[model samples]
Target chain A: MAWVWFHRFGSPPHFYRLATRLTPWFAWPAALLCLAGLIGGLVLAPPDYQQGDGFRIIYVHAPAAWLSLMVYVVMATSAAVGLIWRMTVAYAVSASCAVIGASFTALALATGMLWGRPMWGTYWEWDPRLTSELLLLFLYLGYLGLRNSIDDVGRADRASAVLAIVGVVNVPIIHYSVIWWNSLHQAPSVMKFGRPTMPAAMLVPLLLMLAGFTAYFVALLLIRARGELLRRERNAHWTAEAAGATATG
Target chain B: MSEQRVGFAAAAAALIARDLRLALRRSGDTLQPLGFFLVVTALFPLALDPQLSLLRDIAPAALWVGALLSSLLALDLLFREDAQDGTLEQLALCGLPFQGLLLAKTAVHWLLTGLPLVLIAPLAATALGAPYEAMPGILAAVLLGTLALSLIGAVGAGLTMSLKRNGSLLALLVLPLAAPVLIFGARATALAIAGEPLAAPLYLLAAFTVLSATLAPWALAAAVRIGLE
Candidate 1:
């Protein structure tokens, strides 16, 4: 039944209904996790042995950075699924993810520069990691621009899908650009497999924050997906009812 | 065992020949990109100083960037006429591969736009006081990189022709993806100006060209088919 419900999510009306009902299921946990993680990260967690409190920015920055990339992969994958299956619902989901992903990427970059200003001695550097993130933002803007430029939804989807797939090559490029181009931004110290660079206390809060962000994204994505589905499916009877309720409310 | 596979050399030559003839009788179609390239290249010198050292340093990047934008400027012209006049539909209906036609068009575009840039670059490089050594690197990079630019631009052009004011939209699509090409090309020429080894970055430029050449036409064909459908 759960799997069946998951399958029904591709239907706009069903998904809209389910999302409205289950928004709380994700929201409560996301809020709780974020609140706890922020508290742990800000006060309870020990100051970095070297950098003191400055390192705490990682609690927010790292998870947002991870989501920035994760959201992109999700968007691209959904786009591919839409193109392959010719599913309008999947394209709607992909388009919604792109906006959320772009914002998260901007957050990650903004906070990263804030940390870098004090730590790296500069607010901006052409560091591959930072530059790649900037490029990712441009790719997102370009996708949206292309989407909006095409008034036709079907053509927009196909065009944006091609752009998404091609732009995906940059994900690997950006991921590896640090190694390839040589930059000051150090590689991931926490997500490594063997062991984390920081102590367990730092690592735990960071992981919790990451989980909190994951939940946040899932909740936001479903909400936006519902909006997109309603817009695209407004001709359908279910959409009219959903639109009516949302409008009145 | 009946028919031999067509070599790239032969196929490329055939395609290039086809486009040259198409543009020869229809010469006005090709002039806009050339004029745009000249005007854009001329803009930087006027907007900025004409000092030799300054021009020398910025020359390679400006020339390459101009070439890139001009080629992209011309990209919309690649498919719009075909699409507008329903020649694209006929091409689709024709037995010959549509991808081949796209490739042929791109090859022509490179020849018309790219070759002229290479030929004109030496003079422009002189105007900017680009050292003689920077000449080959600049020419080679622009020649190969512009081909890839048009190739990818063809894909973007195909996607956007069905839309309104597609020229600006085409640039938004192609320029971001073209960043690596432009960067590598500019850096390679810059390194040459400073008398450094460029073999490594030149290899990257060549690889980009090959990669785009092999892939972009297929994507363009797909976009055109989707638009038609």
Candidate 2:
């Protein structure tokens, strides 16, 4: 019985309908939480004793960085699922993940640089986290480029799925190795992990923003997945009926 | 399942030997990247001030970058000819395992492209004013580093094999993934130049090389199969 449900959910037309039904559940709460988190973080959160209000960038930066990493894991997992199960919906989900992850990575980098300029006196430092994040951006670009360059959707999905899986394996190695490399060169910086030391006031809003961003990602992913499913499944009878219903109704 | 099938080791050896012979016959495929390595390293001196101290400081990194670009320049050749001639399909259909064949191809690629880079690294370092004391560590690092690069490059080469023109695209796909090799390789040499303990970085490079060597051939084989399909 569960297997039947799973297969139905995996089907493009069924998944498309499910995504449409679910998008609003994710989107509105995400938007509201983001607004509340931004206001709470930017205006209400107490300024840091050491760094002052410049530390406020953490509200945006940390969440974006978290989302960027989380999204890649999601993308790679979905890609692997697609590869193993031969599920087109899974491929659509993975394909939709690339651009969103890239945007979050770019946001993280930009906000990080903004925060860095005031504190470190340089716009960029070859710090481990920053460097690894930049590398993650490159990995995203490579995945997108590979996908776009191939004309056949199925081939693109298979090839890019392989790259994503390979990259997922490397991400941890890249992260830890970069950290090791950084330790030899410089002392630990202000932008390193903050879980243990950060005050609750600061940590709370950051967590809120993180949750909000993740919800936003889910909402956006479903929206994008629907479009991808439509295009990829256009030849199917269900998609044609759905298109006609939307057109006429 | 057939009794007439060639043994895996024998088949792998045959593939390696075939690739090596082809590379040797062409000669240009092997030497062109070596020339590119030398020229790229040579240009750094002309581009920068000829101050020996500055050159020495930058030498490890410069040489590593040169090696990386040169290896990338040669990566496209890894599967291109076989792919063009349908040899890849024939090999895939043969009784030998795809992973073993890919491993052999990667080994031959490293021998032709990466081995020469490792051999000539010292000369590039010397030209760039890397200290004499750093030579052994530089050599060891390059040797391990280039092996890792070739193994990793095989996956990239396989991924891009079906594309008609993929020079820059191959580099783009490979370079970011290859970052650890560059980082550890350059740092190991730098530590050696500074007379610091070389154990950690060299160990890291060795571990990375081993990890890539073990894992990459499977991915390469998969990518090659996808390209063939």
Candidate 3:
């Protein structure tokens, strides 16, 4: 019985309709939360004693970094689902996640550099997390490049899915090895993140921003997945009705 | 059951033997990446200040990066040739475990490309002013690191087998995935050069090789099947 709902969900027409219907549900909340989180973080939260306003970049940097990692996991999971079940909707979701994920990863790195220049006295540091995030960006680009270069949609989907899965398996090992390398080099000074007990005022806005970013990703994913579904299903008969319904309704 | 096991081993051996023969027939093709490795390492000294102290300091990174680029140079030979000649399709339809067949192919890749890199590493490192005592460490690190890279690159090769212009795309896809191998391999070499205990990084490199050895063939097999499709 549950499988029936899953199969229906995997169907292109069903997914298209559901995604279109659901986009507003996520989009409105995402907008409101991000607005609230920004106001609260930038205005409400107290400045850190050490770094002052320079630390405020964390509100953007932390969430972008989190989304960067989260989106890859989402992509890999959907890619796996697509490969295992041959679900077109899953592939569409995976495809929609890549560009968004790469953008967030770039945001994280840029913000990290902005924060690092004043804090670390350098624009870049070979810190493990930073290095791993840079590599994560490269991995995303690789996935997108592989997908774009392959001419056949089915072949591209399966091949990039294999790459995504392989990447997911390697991420942890990469992270660990980078950490080991960092330990060997042992930088002059380490940048400590939040205190052992972060104040609620500061923590609340960060949590709100994280939630907001997640909601925003879902909203964007639904919108993009709808378009992806349309492209993949151009020849399917239901697309005509779906297009018409969207045009009128 | 014993007979079936023997049959599997024989099949794997035959596959390895076939690839080795192909590699030998095109000896220049086999040697070309090694030559690239030598040139890449040689370029570093010319590009940067060739001070003995600086060279010693950067030798680990230099040798490891060279190994990486050269291995990438040969990755196409892993599956592209077989794919072009339709051997991939036959192997897929041969009614054997596809992953095992790929593992045999990857093993052959390691023998032709990876092993020679390992043998040449100490020479390259020494020329770069790496200490004589570091020779065994450099040798071991290269041996294990190159094997891990071959296994990893096989999947990339399989992924790109059907593409018309795959050289750069193959590097783009494989290099990020192979970053950990570089990190561990270079660190091990650095530790050897600095006269530190090399056990930790060497152990990590070995573990990574074992992990890739176990998993990459499955990924490569899946990729080959998809490319063939």
Q: Judged by lDDT, which candidate is best?
A: 3
Predicted structure 1: lDDT: 0.77
- Which candidate would rank higher by TM-score, 1 or 3? 3
lDDT of 2 by residue, B1-229 (tens): 6658679999889888988888889897679999999999898888989999889888887888988998888788789889989999999998678888888898888888788888888888888877788889989999999999998889998999998756478888999999999889989988888878898889999999999988998889889999999
The residue pairs that clash in candidate 3, if any, are none
Off by over 4 Å in 1: A1-22, A174-195, A235-249, B1-29, B35-56
Interface RMSD of each: 2.1, 0.9, 0.8
- For model 1, what share of native contacts is present? 0.41
Please give the distance, in angstroms, between residue A205's alpha carbon in candidate 3 and its true position after superposition.
0.7
What is candidate 1's lDDT per residue for A1-249, written digit by digit as tens?
Answer: 666754676666777888788877887789999998998899899987666788888899889889988988888888988898777778888888888888988998898889887776888866666777888888888888888887767777887888787778656743453344443235543212214467777888888888989998988887888888876775788876777666554
Candidate 3 falls in which docking quality class?
high
The chain B TM-scores of all candidates, as shown, are 0.86, 0.95, 0.94
Which candidate comes out best when scored by DockQ? 3
Docking class for candidate 1? acceptable
lDDT of 2 by residue, A1-249 (tens): 769988998988899889999999999989988898898898888998888898898889998999999999999999999989999999999999999999999999999999899989999998888999999999999998888888899899999999999999999999988988899889987665575988777887788888899999999999999888887886798886666666554
Reference-based TM-score of each model = 0.85, 0.96, 0.95
On DockQ, who's better, 1 or 3?
Answer: 3
Give the Cα lDDT of each candidate: 0.77, 0.89, 0.90
Encode model 1's per-residue lDDT on B1-229: one tens digit a residue.
Answer: 6966665556557756866887788778677777777777777888888887787678767877887887886677777777888877976876567788767777777788777777887777667677887788878877777877888788888878777565477787788788767767877777777778888778877887888888787788888887676
